[model samples]
Every structure is written in C-alpha cells, then in structure tokens.
Target: MAYRDQWKMLHLLNTSMRGALKETELIEMGIDCYPDTIQYLKDDGIVEMDGTGVYSLNPMVRRMLNKFMIAMGAGDMKEIYVDVPSCFIVMPFSEEWSDTVFYDFIQPAVIKSKMECVRGDMIPRVGKLSENIVKQIQRTGLVIADISVPNANVFYELGIADAIGRDVFLLYEKNIEQNLPADIQGAHYYAYDRNNIPESVERFAESLIQWKELYRVDVTLKYCRK
Candidate 1:
C-alpha cells in the first residue's frame, strides 16, 4: 500500500472526530521507526495491501490483534456513522454508489479494524430517510447527524431515531440556534462555529459511545429476559 492509504488506514483506526492526527502527526509518532510499517505487516502476512494503498483486512487475523490491543489497555470500540441529506456520494460508485470525501477518510479504517461503523446518506427524500432511520436504529449502536440547516432531511431522521428510542446525536452550525426547536434543545447537540468542524464532531462521537453502551445494556436486558 502507498503511504497515503497506509496513513489513512492508521488514522481511521486511531482517529475520532474527537481528534485527527495528520501525516505530520504520524511522522512524529514514529513513521520513521518503521518507514515501511505496511510492508512489514504485509510481509509478515498480517496486513493485505492492494492497489494504490487499498488493502483488505482478514477479519480473523484482525481479531487476534484486537485481542492483544485490548489486553494492552487499548480503549473501547470506536465508531461513527455519517448520516446526511443525500446518498448522492456513498462509494464504490459502480456497485454501492457510496463515495464521498467523508467516507474516503473513514470507511477503510472501519472495515479493516472490524469496528462497528455505518452511515446513512442514500435516501434523497426526507420521508424516505425518516423511515429508513427507524429501520437502522434497530441495529445501530448510535446516531450522529448534522442539522446545521433547518433541513428536512436532518429533522426527520432525528425524529425517527428518537421515536425508536435510539440514542440521537446532533450537530449544527452555531448559526442554526434560531432555527432549531425547543424539543431538539433537549437532545444532545454540539455547535461548530465558523468551521470548527472537528471539535464538535469528536464530542458528539465520544458522547454517543457512552450513551450507546447504556442503551445497549438496558435494551438487551429488557428483551433477553422477556
């Protein structure tokens, strides 16, 4: 794999909207110690690198590594799904039609790490996305949405996610304060002002992780015993 994709994979594993470590960050983190970490992992037959930095993860192998990381004090499972106004850009364009800059940065890591991650962007219509949100909530760990605008898309998805009793996360530009409703104010929200995109995103992701675990435990107990 090329340095760029290898770097992307590492970021996906290590980053959350809580923080992003750029290329320079990795170099400082010891990209020099193993200028060929990807090759080493590959040659050792641990990582499978493909064309132009693209790589396929062997899940069974990854689980073994994850086990080690857990024992060594690696943290909780990290995941974030980007739900949006349009599925216009979900990647693998020819097949899944779900490609976007956001996906580009995040998807590879999620798939490779065997992390629980997903996104909702395909429904171009508000009503459709709303219904789909409920369906997804059934299996999702949490929901993150951007309603920076009084968009029909974000509003309805938020509604459905709440209605289904799934934990809901919200992000909106500081400017949207006037447009959002009183009820929504009670839902967890983070406002990114003037393009401070990464900060708000990270907060929502981390909070969702905590919220999701509680939901999971409570719901599991409710259903399992009944």
Candidate 2:
C-alpha cells in the first residue's frame, strides 16, 4: 500500500464527524478520495461504506493500525498525522478550583513539558459528555488526575483511565496524599501546596519532565522490537 494512501485513510478516519463521512464531505475538507486507495482498503476490509456513500473505518482494523504504529516506536506518531501530545486531566472542576488547580498548577506544568493540557469539561463535542470524556481519555498520551477531594466523578474518570492502561499521574493537596483509595495506594502520585503555588508548580513541572522521560522509556522498552 502507498504511504500516502495510508496517511490519507488514517486522516479521514479521525477527521470524520459522526463516525462517518460522505465523499462530498471529504472533498469539502480538502481530502481527495483516491479511487485506488479506497478500493484497496475496501478489498482489505479496512474501510467500510454504506448504501448512501458514507465512509467509515473498520474499528478492528483501526485498532490494529494504531497498535502497529505504536509498536514501531513512532512516539506520538506526528509524521503520520498532525497531533500534539496531550495530557487529559481528570479532576474536580469548580470555578475557583479550575483556576487555582488546573489553570495555575497543572496547565503550566503540562505546557512546560511541551504537551497540550486538557480537561474533560474543556473539550467540545456534540454528544453525551461522558462519551466525549472517554474519547478524550483514549486519545491523550498521559492522564493527570487530581484526587485531592474524594469526588465520585473524579474517581470514576480515574477508573476509566486506569482500566484503559493510560499513563496516570495523580496529584493531591499536601496533607491528604495518604488518604487515597486502597486500590490506588501503590500508584504514582505527587502532593502539592496551595499556598506555595509558584514553587509547587515548579516542583510539579520537574516531576512532569521526569515522568515524560520515564513514559517514553517504558513505551520504547515495551514495544520496540530488538
């Protein structure tokens, strides 16, 4: 298969809204539906079409392609598609806390590590918010979850991130680090001080850089074949 075809197919698969796109939509989006490329994927069962001419990627094939790309040690896969490595923060959101914890603390640290920082509520989607949250969690390279307060929704998001084997970094306020749930007692986490915001963020950025290095090492070691 041509590399351009693969790239075009992958791009279309991700950019399609509502999980499928008609050929006209592809053209409007400036993507050409090369007949040979489409036919190749169709013959291989990698792409599907409906009676009305909407195209969708086969889910299983998409999964296999993603895993193969990852296993080939294409860290972040930027060459194949335009994407900035992003970190999805699973945390309790409130007006004050969003500013204090996320905007001030986590966002700077994530930016310092050269990644986009996003939260579940920050993403815009036209579906159930929960489904959007799951999709964001799946797309991100790292998950930073603030378990400072025992909110059920925070823990629920954390569970979803954990269940899907995301690289999670937990954070909590200074004194409550020891009070985390038993299930995540052994997980990686950091404690931050609210009063010492600047210093705390500096320390968090340092840790985040180290975490990114460790994450890269882990992925390369686990997936890169000798």
Candidate 3:
C-alpha cells in the first residue's frame, strides 16, 4: 500500500462523473495532493487536469478502476470507502404481473450486468412512500422503468427519474407498446413478450450492459474522515 493515498483519491474520483477534485477540496479530505502526489498521478496518466487546480480521473483509467473494484469485490471497496453502483426498478407493486416481471426479467438482467437491483417496495419504509422513492431514485446510478400497464404511480416515478437526469431504461410488454402515452412514444424502449421470459432477460441484460458502458452511470462518493 505504498500509494494508498493515491488509491483512495482515485476511488473517490471514480465515484462521480460530475466534476473534478479541486486542490483545496483534497485538503478537506485530509489528502496530501498539492505537488508530490498530484505529480505522481500526472506522470502515470491516471488523472487529468480539468483546469489549473482541478483534476479528474482519466476516462479509461476510471473504467480500469471499476474493473479492479469488481475483481476485488464491492465489499472490499466499501471497506476503503467506495460506493457500490446500483440500479433502481420503477414499477407497479403488489400485482401478479409485478412479481413475474421483476423476478423473471428485471432482477436477473440487472444481476447479469454486475449491479444491485432494488425497487420501491423492497426498501423498508422510513417516511412517506413518495419521499422514499425520490430518495432511492436520486441515490441510484441507473433506473429501470416498466410502463407495461400505464400505472399512474409508475409514470410519476419515471418523471422524477427523468427530471433528476438518472440513466433510464424503459421497458414494456410488446402488446402495449402501441398503446403507450403519446408523450413517451418517441422514447426508446425494450418490449418483451410474456411467454419469452428467458430470451427477454438475456436480451435486456445485453442491452443494459452496452447502454451502461456508453452512458457511464452517474455515481457519487464522498470522502469520510476516519
């Protein structure tokens, strides 16, 4: 762990795609990056300067860091303060179809893509249901919205995800694609058949993998003082 401080900095920077780490902010995290460590990182090409005194992880290096974290196990990263990426599912709950779609299709697909999958109903109630949903949407890196039955709550949740700029993946039953609201008719979606569970899950998983790589989910991690 000769470069443990640098490792910690990269883990934190890789957590978000948003902005760079300013030199002053590094001091707040108790990181010594003024000249020596920052020069070490620049020489290695692991990070790039966004401006005069700000730096962010290089895109390719970020991907490598993600792979390293995965290989080392998410739990191991948590021990070092890295946040795990997660996908939240937005769908109508307590319906017969809900169980089928979540278990048979969505959950498996999310698992295949190496991310945690959670839904509104799955979380323990803390305050209002709407409030919890909003919190989860904001916390998650990606959102998967199922608009198969035109449920009002689902639509509202989907709108929140959109407003907050989370990476969203729309899904629907093939039969209802034509009946979807005109507002979202132009949006891209995956239509699955009820009878084709396994195949649909595979296709959805593959598509999700490709989409994640292209968009690079928005994730954030803050340095916690020990």
Candidate 4:
C-alpha cells in the first residue's frame, strides 16, 4: 500500500533470508509476510521459490542493474550492495560435534576473515543430490570440507569441486578411516583430532594463511610437463 509499508515488507523478507528463517517458521520478532507476497516476488523474478517453501535470492548483475535502479531511484541503496563471498562447506553428518563447532565457532572465524559461509541446514534444498548443493559447489570459490566418514556424496562432490578447479581446503578426522576413494588419493588433504579441535582448526587455518594461494600455483606450474 504505502511506500514505507513496502520497504517494511522488503525488510521482513531480507530478515527471513539473512537470519536463515524458514518459510513456516515465524520469527519471534513478528513478521506478517504472506505466502502470496513471496510467490509474487518469485513471479516477478525478484526471488526464486524452489521445491518446498524455501525462497532463494534472485541475483542480478548488480553493477549494471543497480545503476538503472539508482538512476531511476527505484530501490533502496543499501539493498543494492552487500559483500558476502560465497563459501561452500561439505561434510558428513551435520549434527556431529565438530560440524557444530565449525558452524558456530570455526565458520565465524573464517567469515571474520571475510567470506560468506553456507552450511548444509542453511541450504535451501534437502536430500543428498539437490540443486542447492550443486549450485553452491559451482558458485563457490572456496570449499572447506571433511571426508572423514564414508560418504559417497562427499567423495563425489569433492572430485567435482576439484574438476572445476576449486580451492578446496581438505580435512579429515585423525585416526579415522578416510572415506575417500583411493582413485582420488592424489587430492590434497590434512587430518585433525577432534580431541583438540580448536588447536587442530588453528593449525588448519595457519597452514591456509601461510599458503601463497588458495590453489597451488607452484604445483601446477611444476606439473605442467607431466
């Protein structure tokens, strides 16, 4: 109805997304968003409503689209610009304690270092082979994954990420049988002991910091002949 009300609606939608709010789950903060509005936005190509009730961001060439939106004074300036470097995180069981620490503690540490971290639960889709997982893997420039457990999907996705030339930071639980396929043993990796997750995480991060690039340029240069 009113411009202020429309802005409020955008705020609610943005909050739902940014806070990882689900469609059916209402926030205690009181948002009165209706399904129809969400659908309308999707129809307008402003958002993408996929299988299930989850809503996904409708990305645009903001550098170009925003120029038009701004020249016409059509949208909020704040909404036009936000930096969240896409990060793909693959793991085995999501509820594992180490997973939670990565979600709660280690991920924030990575994000604080300036990156947008997305987890399994926060993913818009479910099941092992959903488009959400696939798209995230393709879009992400960085991947921090664990292949300690016997997960076919993890191994499959790891190989795919490698094929796409992603900068993957591999991790596995120490003393545990690596679920990775022997064929892909050439993939780079490191192990961690959950007994000292913090220290192990610190070690992982330190190794990452000391590296010259996300992907090994030197190794690639040397292996070009072979």
Worst 10 residues of 3 by lDDT: 71-80
| CA displacement after TM-score superposition, residue 137 of candidate 1 (Å) | 2.5
**Candidate with better TM-score, 2 vs 4:** 2
* Model 4 alpha-carbon drift over 4 Å, by segment: 1-85, 126-129, 177-180, 211-226
Mind giving the per-residue lDDT tens digits that candidate 4 earns over 100-190?
A: 6575545754654455677744676543444455546654546777777767677667766665445576677777754554665445577
Candidate 1 per-residue lDDT, tens place, 1-226, comes to 2453353334233322322333343333333334465556557665555454444444555555344432212133322122211111112222231233235433432333233556665433444443444445433544556554455655666665565344455655577688866766546776654445345445544554454343232222221211
Per-residue lDDT tens digits for candidate 2, residues 1-226, read 2544445555446543465767665544334546756777778888899999988878886666565543222234311221225778888787356568887899988888777788777788755666666666766767888888888888888877665556688888887866777778546788888888888889888887876554342222121121
By TM-score, rank the candidates, best first. 3, 2, 4, 1
Candidate number with the higher lDDT (2 or 3): 3
Q: How many residue pairs clash in each candidate?
A: 9, 0, 0, 0
- In candidate 1, position 121 carries an lDDT of 58
lDDT-wise, the better of 3 and 4 is 3
The 10-residue segment of model 2 with minimum total lDDT is: 217-226
Pairs in steric clash, model 4: none
Q: Judge candidate 4 at residue 120 and give its lDDT.
A: 46
Clashing pairs in 2: none
lDDT of 2 at 95: 38
What is the Cα root-mean-square deviation between model 1 and the actual structure?
Answer: 17.4
